[model samples]
Target: MYILKKNEKFNIDNETITFREIRDKLTEEFTELVKAIVNYSYDKTLKNLKAVVREAFDVIQVCILILRKCHTISKDLDYPD
Candidate 1:
């Protein structure tokens, strides 16, 4: 998203976005995804499908943002997989 494309321009509460903010956002998005999944499991309606898709995308987008922001620290870590 725009944050990944222009992270320098993004701000939250008049402050730069931080890992804590990202973590909080990720947690909230994931919780919404779980709620959507649970609702879909019982309803199985088109509306529920759309909700699930939307929530999933939200979770994925936040994850992508995290990955994009983590590039700076990736060099300091080791990956065997």
Candidate 2:
């Protein structure tokens, strides 16, 4: 997880990705959807929005997979008393 300062700067190390990157990527996708909806015809815009949503869902699924893998690794490293 990356922490943001008051000025909205993130402190992420080079080797690791912070949650902020995921959030920003999602936000950019949503903005693209909104732009497509506003600038294109109804049918075309709807298709574009659907595509954007599918892509966003894929990103979320990837994040979930990564988190699950991390959880499994963490559990393996724990000691039972």
Q: Pick the candidate with the highest TM-score.
A: 1
Tens digit of per-residue lDDT, candidate 2, span 10-79: 2323235555665665476566556665555455667677776665564554455346446545776755
Runs of candidate 1 with Cα error greater than 4 angstroms are: 1-15, 72-81
lDDT of 1: 0.74
Q: Local distance difference test, per candidate?
A: 0.74, 0.51
Question: What's the true lDDT of residue 42 in model 1?
Answer: 99
Which stretch of 10 consecutive residues in model 1 shows the poorest summed lDDT?
Answer: 6-15
Cα RMSD for candidates in order: 4.9, 8.7
Q: Where does the lowest 10-residue lDDT sum fall in candidate 2?
A: 1-10
**Best by lDDT, which number?**
1
